[model samples]
Target: MAHIVVLSGAGISAESGLPTFRDVGGLWKQYSVHDLASPGGWERNPQLVLEFYNTRRQQAREAQPNAAHTALAALESQHRVTIITQNIDDLHERAGSSNVVHLHGEIMKARSSVDESYLVEMNDQDIALGDLCPQGKQMRPHVVWFGEMVPMLESAADIVATADVLLVVGTSLQVYPAAGLVDCARPNCPITVIDPGEDVKVKGATIIRKTACAGVPEWIASLKL
Candidate 1:
């Protein structure tokens, strides 16, 4: 079977009604997500950061996987599918994709400040101010905040490098490290980009300019995979 690696971004979750990180309006208009999503911001006001992610987690919990997510999961029956996502949400896993690597960490998990290995599942809910890990340290969102190194980048890159086919979904290919994973794919591997936006700049990629919900299922149907 061919190895298919998929790189998903916030756009996939956006179709399920989860807010995109960069979109203006709603809570974003009231406050910049960047302010609450960085280590420096966490230090200045951990409460604010915790509250922000708490709200995001609640939203993610209430959201359901959309057509794109399901189609990607179904592709596993015909191909070896591995998903590497920048999304903090678990929509991919909920959609039944067995293999997923979260480059941005998961909103449904919390980690100990003292020990990186100490992690606890949050069940897609809140991590309050006083929440502590077994190590007796304050718990922090497991996410890879801005300015923080993405620990999963190397692994994701390796997966991309070995892929027989690569699918770029929803993401604009803007963010670092994670965005750069596309560069790791083998020179001759076929690449496809699915997004509603115009003129995505992935050289030699076949672009499907449509929303993830509409484009992914259509693409899969065409492939008969």
Candidate 2:
């Protein structure tokens, strides 16, 4: 079977009703990127940090995977599909995709603030200010915040390098490390990028200029894998 590697981002989840950070700008949700997404913000106010992620977790719980997620999951029946996602949500897993690597960590998980290795799965319940890990240390969201190292980048790159087919969806490819995974693909590998926006520029990738929901199924059909 062919190995299909999918690199997905927030844009794919947006079709499922989850809001992206870039779209949250304006007075109603006035938090700046640095204020809620960085370690400095967590240090400045852990409670606010907890609250921000709590809301996101709740939102994630309510959203369901869309057509793109389902189509990707379905590919596993015909090919070896591995998903590398910039998203923290479990949509891919929920949609029944067997293999998924989360580059940004997951929202439904927590780790010891003192011991990064003491990671734990969080139930659907929201994380509060006083939440403590098994080691009695303060628990923080497992997400890889700004300035934090993405430990899975190496693994993702390896997956990309071996892909028989590469599919990119809903990402602008502006973020580093994760964005650079496309470069790891073998020069002769076929790449298809799905996005409705016109600003994406990925060298050597064939653009499928359509939204995730509208484009993925059509593109998958064309693959005939």
Candidate 3:
């Protein structure tokens, strides 16, 4: 069976009612990126950080998996599929994908401020200010913020190296390390990028000028399986 590796980003989640940061009038417009997702921001106002994520967590919960997410999940039945996503939401899992590598961390979980190993799952709940981990440190969203190293970068690269077919979805190829993962694929591996943005580009990739929701189902239909 073909081992298909998928790299997804915020664009994929946008269709699920979870608006991307660039989307106008979205929640992101009210907060600065540094304030909502940065170590310095957490240090300056942990309460604000907690509140922002709590709202986002709730939004993620309300969002449903889009058609693109479902198509990827069904592909797993015919091939070995591994999804490496920059999105922190659980829509992919909700769509029935069994194997997913969340590069940005999961929104449905929290961790100790000082201990990355100490994790707690919080479903449809909020992480209050006083919420403390076993390590006695305040609980923070289990997400990789700005200025923090991506914990899954190495593992994602390793997985990408083994892909017989590499699929890129919704990402602008602007983020580092994650964007560079395309380089790790085997020289001749089939690489396809699904995005409508004219600026989105990956050398040697088959670019599909369509949204993930529209392009993914079409791609799945073309599969020999």
Q: Which candidate number maximizes lDDT?
A: 3
- Candidate 2 TM-score versus the reference: 0.96
User: lDDT per residue, candidate 3, 1-225, as tens digits?
Assistant: 899999999999998889765552455578788987899999999998898888888889999999999999999889999999999999999999999999999999999999999999898689999999886789999999988999999999999999999999989989887899999999999899999999987889899999999999998887663
Worst 10 residues of 1 by lDDT: 24-33
Local distance difference test, each candidate: 0.89, 0.90, 0.91
lDDT of 2 by residue, 1-225 (tens): 999999999999999999886674444277766778898988988887788888888889999999999999998998999999999999999999999999999998888888888887877787777888887878999999999999999999999999999999999999997989999999999899999899888888899999999999999999966
Candidate 3 local lDDT, residue 3: 95
- Model 3 C-alpha RMSD to native: 1.4
Give TM-scores for every candidate, taking all chains together and pairing residue i with residue i.
0.95, 0.96, 0.96
Model 3, residue 70: what's the lDDT? 96
Per-prediction backbone clash count:
0, 0, 0
Q: Candidate 2's error at 151, in angstroms?
A: 0.8
**Residue 82 shift from truth in candidate 3, angstroms:** 0.1
| Candidates arranged by lDDT, highest first | 3, 2, 1
Q: What is the C-alpha lDDT profile of model 1 across 1-225, one tens digit per residue?
A: 889899999899999999887662466567665688888888888998888888888888999999999999999999999999999999999999999999999999999977878898988458999998886889998998888889999989999999998999999998887889999999999899999998568999999999999999888787633
What is the lDDT for 36 in model 2? Answer: 86
